[model samples]
Every structure is written in structure tokens, then in C-alpha cells.
Target: MERFFKLKEKGTDVRTEVMAGLTTFMTMAYILAVNPAILGTTGMDSGAVFTATAVASAIASFCMALFANLPFVLSAGMGLNAYFAYTVVAGMGYSWELALTAVFAEGIIFILLSLTNVREAIFNAIPATLKYGVSVGIGLFICFIGLQNAHIAVDSSTLVTIFSFNNSIKNGTFQSEGITVVLALLGILITGYLVIRGVKGNMLIGIFATWLLGIICQIAGLYVPDPDHGFYSLIPSGILSAPASLAPTFLKFDFASAFAHPLDFFSILFAFLFVDVFDTLGTLIGCASKADMLDEDGKLPEIKGALLADSIGTVVGSCLGTSTITTFVESSAGITEGGRSGLTAVVSGIFFLLALFFSPIFLAIPSFATAPALVIVGFLMIQQVVKVQWDDLLEAIPAYVAIFAMPFLYSISEGISLGIISYVILHVAAGKSKEVTPLMYVLAVLFILKYIAL
Candidate 1:
């Protein structure tokens, strides 16, 4: 194991890697249940999705370990899956099978890009300020998502509002509600305190603490189930069961149907490819930095292999009836636990496979429990904001737009699009056109066309 993973070279041992792996799994295990619930809305079988989620995650994480020697764990990405279900299937009137085909196409393109080192060139093209901004933007996006999942930030008619029973009393209900808000707050307090004290696996500890408290709320009749809004009463039917059958969703992609509308299909393919490319690059750089894994030139080592592993994961996941699989930002949790080698990913992969048999235990963990980890991760990621050169308006403006637009507009691609277009326009208008890269101009034009098509 030591020779295979180069444990000494990475300055980590098997015990530390195992602990980090468990910590990473605990922080991200929420996906096993959430993926199924979200995708099931599109007429896919929930059980099949649950099975595919575990199997795909295991395969992806294992590949990352063996191929790239990176600690990052790959899973069905959260934002991409939501886009597949709601935007592609329900809104755009495409079938789920066709959406899978689009994802498959995206994977093939990504694999080609990685093989040719085209993806690495694109990563190099992004401005340093915008790259840092992407980290902060994703951090804010993660926090916003956590707030919504925990019911601490509720959507009003026009904007997001803090959910408080006291605030809501004047409008309708006389009695107090919004138990999720209280639960999330408690979770934040506990996790924050534990982190301050330098506790190992603090996020994992905080998740279980919040989950137990939520169960207590259920006993007191305060916890309520609202399936439409994604709230569950923390109930479970049993403790153990056989893994769900994967026959329904396995290899369900419809290649012929997906290619029927060539233009629209190409546009859809671009959306998937664009998002996956930036998201993976951003995540790899951000998380690897946390582990001090970047080279002296500030580039991730063996990046092509990492990209290839991720591309392979997405392709295989599509065949297995899941959304695009990518390296998760939650792997930062493992890095925080002293994970510095591929051994961490290997152990996490094993845990994911084992989780297939213990679905009931993991599935019962409520959104509020995992919400705290997401919020804490957002805090960790936003630390990159300090690295931005705030005094230069030319650089600062685009970075600021990218940071705010992510959570506000609810689209990473949109935020990146606005940032790229504005950056090029501002540089050219200011007679600093020489600073703008040729690729940036091409991206700006493509983004403009993308918005026009919408």
C-alpha cells in the first residue's frame, strides 16, 4: 500500500488516510439519498438511482485514486443533476434518457480534451483574479445552497429572506415554526466551536450532533414532513435491507433520440461540457491548494490524469443511469483531516461501496445535518478571497461580479460568462487589450451567443 500510493513522498500514512477518508465520506454521504430523490422526480425509479449513486461514486473515486493519485472523491454532482432533472427533462421537454445521452456526449468530449491537453490550456487561460474569484463564488454558492436546504434562508416573492417563525407570525401562522432554521443554527454553532478548538473530524461530529437533535425534535412533534419542499420527518422503515435493483436505470441513455435535434442538442451539450470543464478545474485547483499539493508554479501536478479520471467517471456514470460525475468540493473536508495521498481516495471509495448495504442509515440523515458541513465548507473556500488584489478596479470589478452573481443568479456558468465578457470589454475599452488572451475573446463571443439563444 505504501509503495503503491507513495505514502512517504506525500507525507501521509495509512491511518491518517483512513481517518480522512471516513471524514470525507461522512461529510458527503448526504448525496446517496439526495441524488435519488431529485432524479426520481423525472419518473426514474428512486431505488435504482440510489443504487447507481453508490456504485458510480465508488467507481469514480477509485479511478481518481489509481489514475491521478489525488485524494478527491468523485460523485454525481449536485448542481448538474438538478439541471438534468428540472431544466432538461421537465422544462425543456426532453426525455430523461436523452439528457443522459447529452451527458455521455459531454464525457466523450471531455475525454478528448484531456487526452489532447486542451482542458489544461483552457485552465491556464483563466485570469488569476477570476480563478480566485471562482473559488469565492463557489463558496458563496455552496453557502446559499446550504441555507436553502436547511430552511434558514427561504425564498420570498422576489428575493431570499431569512426564515424566522417570529417574522412569519405577522403574516399567517400565530405559533412558531421553522424548526429547520433553529436546527441549522445549532449545528453551525456546534461545528464552528469544534473547529475553533481544532477538533479532528469536527464537521462529521457536528453532522451527527445535529441529526440526533433533529430526532429529538421528531419525538417532540416539532419536526414536520413537507415532501414538496424536501423536508422529511427523520423516519426510517428499517435498519438494513438488500441493495436496490439497478435494472430500471442501467444503460438507459438514448443516443439516437438525443441527436434528433442537432442544433438544440449541440447547445445542450455545450452547457454540460462548459459547466463540467470549469467546475472540475476550479474544484481541483481549490481543493489541491488546501492540501499544499500544487507545484512551485501553482499548478496541480498530473492534471491531465485527473481530468481523464473525471471524464471517465462521467461517461461510466451516464451508462449507469446517473448524472455527470465529477470531483466534489466536499473533498476539502478530507484534506482538512491530513489526507495527502491517493490512499485517502481509495478508502473513501471502499466506504461508498459499503454504503450500498447500509442505505437506510445514511438515507435517514436529514438535510439540516449535512447543511452545516456545506456552510462550513463555504467558509473555508471563501478564504481565497483574501488573495484577490482588491485595490485594482480593473481586476476587482469582474471578480466582484463573479462572486456575487453565483449565489444571486444561481448559475456558476452564468457568473463565469458575465465575468469573462466584462473582463474582456473592460480591458479593451481601457486600452489594455494586449492583456486579454485570444481565448478570452472567443469565450466572450460564445457566452453572448449562449445568452441570446436562451
Candidate 2:
């Protein structure tokens, strides 16, 4: 292990790597519950999604270990999954099978780009401020999703409003909606406190703790199961269960259907590719920097292998019926714990594989329980807002538009579209056309045409 992973040179040991990997797994394990919940909203089988999530995560992380020899782990990305389910399938009204095909295509494109300088050029083409905006926008979008899942934000005459305990009281359904909302709020507080205390795996602990509380409420008769209204039993049928069959979602791509809608297919493909490229690059850079793994050029070593691992993960995940898999920023948790080699990733991957056997535990976790983790993760992602050059209106305005457009418009692609178009137009209007990259101009024109033509 020492010779293979260069533990002595990297100043880390097998034990340290093992601990770091476990730390990484604990930190990110919330996705085992959250991914299925998010994707299940798109009519996918929750059990199958749970299985797919675990299997895809394990495969991707293992690839990260063996291919890149980096400490990074991979999984179906949070925002990309949202774009797949909410934007492509729900908003654009595409079948989930076709959406999978787009993901498969994106992965193939990523593989090509990873083999050349094209990916780097595209990464450099987008302004850093806009990248920060996209991150913040996705953060807000995820937080909004958490709120909706918990029913903390409910539909109203004004379009959105808080869940009303008073209304539930009058309607005598307080045991269902009101209690769940209250528990969700309490879960947020609990999770926030855990974060404040600098707890490792705070989000995961928050999820389990909140879920346990709900179970207690059900036992105490304070919260009642209303399967008719989407509430169901919180208790697992058993503590141990076999992994669900992936037959429901496995290898379910509909390439023909996707290709028939050429324009829409490419649009969805671009959205998946654009977000996955930047998100994976950003995460790798951030985590590598945290681990002091970058060279003098501020670039990660073995990045091609890393990108290949990530792209391959996406393709494999799509084939296994999941969304785009990418390097996770949560791997930074392991990095902070002295993980500097792929052994750490290998350990995390092992944990993911082991998680497959615990499907009942993960699946029994309700959306409300996972809601706090999503909100907390969103808060973590939103911290990138500080990196944006807020003083420069040219940069800030487009960033702002992108940031708000996502949750407001309820579409990640729309947010990217408006952000790029506004950025290019504002720069040209201000006689700063020289500052805009040729690629940016092309993207802006394409997005403009997308709106006009599609």
C-alpha cells in the first residue's frame, strides 16, 4: 500500500488514509438518502434509485481511486441530478429515459473533451464571477427544493407561502402537515447547530437524528402517517435488507427518442455538459488545493485521469440509471483529515458499496428528514457568493441574474442562458468586448438563438 499509493512521500499512512476515507464517506453518505428522494420525484422507483445511487457512487469513487490516484470521491452530483429530474424531465417534459440518454451523451462528450485542451478552454471561457454565480444559483435552487420537499414553503395565492400550522389546526390535519413542517424547521436548527459545533458528518447525523425524531412522533401519535397525502410509515420493515433490483431503471436510455428531438436533446446535453464540466473542475481544484496537491502552476496533477474517471462515472451511472457522476467537493472532508492518496477514495468507495445492503434504512428516510441536509449543503455551496466580484456591476449584474433566475424560474438551463447572454451583451454595450472571450460570444449567441428558436 505504501509503495503503490506513495504514502511515505505524501506523508500519509495506510491508517490515516483509511480514516480519511471513512471521514469522507460519512460526510457524503447523505446522498444515499437525498439522491433517491430528488430523483424519485421524477417518477423513478425510489428503491431502484437508491440502489443505483450506491452502485454508481461506488463505481465512480473506485475509478477515482484506481485511475487518478487522487483522494477525490465521485457520486451522482446534486445540482446535476436536479437539472436531470427537475429541469430536463419535469420542466422540459422529456421522458426520464431520454434524459438518461442526454446524460450518456454528455458523458461521452466529456470523455472527448477530457482527452484534449478543449475542456480547459471552455472552463477558462466562462468568467470566474459567473461561475460563482452559477454555484450560488444552484445552492439557492437546492435550498428551495428542500423547502418544498418539507412543505415548509407551500403554494399560495401569492404563489408561495410558509406552511400554516394555524390552517392545519383548523383543518384538523395538524398531525400530518403541521408536525412535519415543525419537524423540518427543527431539523434545520439541529443541523445548523451541529455545523456550528464543527461536527464531522453533521449533515448525516442531522438526517438520522431528524428521522429518529419523526419516528418518535409517529410512535407518540403526534404525527400520523397519511399515505394518501404522501406521508408514509417512517419505520423500516427491517433493519437489514438486500439491495433492490436495478431492473426498474437500469440501462433505460432512450437514444432514439432523444435524437428525434434534436434541438431539445442537444439543449439538455449542453446543460448537463456545461454544469458537469465546471462543477467537476471546480470541485477537483478546490479539493486538490485543500490537500496541497496542486503543483506550482495551480493545476492538479493527473487531472486527465481524474476527468476520465469522472466522465466514465457519468457514463456508467447513466447506464445504471442515474444522473451525471462527478468528483465531489465533500471529498475535502477527507482531505482535511490527512487524506492525500487514492487509498482514501478506495475506502470511501468500499463504504458506498457496503451501503447497498442497507437500502431499507436509506429508503425509509423521508424527504423531510433529508431536507435539512439539502438546506445545509445549499448553505455550504452558497458560500461561493463571497468569491464573486460584487463591486463590478458588469460582472455582478449577470451573476445576480443567474443566481436568482435559477430558483425563481425553476430551471438551471434558463439561469445559464440568461447569465451568458446578459454577460456578453452587457460587456459589448460597455465597450469591453475585448474582455469577452470568443467562446463567450458564441455561447451568448447560441443561448439567444435557443430562446428565439426553441
Best by TM-score: 1
Clashes of 2: 0
Task: Write candidate 1's Cα lDDT for 312-336 as tens digits.
Answer: 9999888888999998888887887
**lDDT value, residue 160 of candidate 1:** 78
Best by lDDT: 1
Query: For residue 5, what is the lDDT in candidate 2?
Result: 88
Stretches of candidate 1 exceeding 4 Å from the true structure: 167-177, 224-229, 233-236
* TM-scores of the candidates in the order shown: 0.91, 0.76
Error of 1 at 331 (Å): 2.2
lDDT per residue for candidate 2 within 370-411, as digits (tens), equals 677667767776777887799999999998998898889875
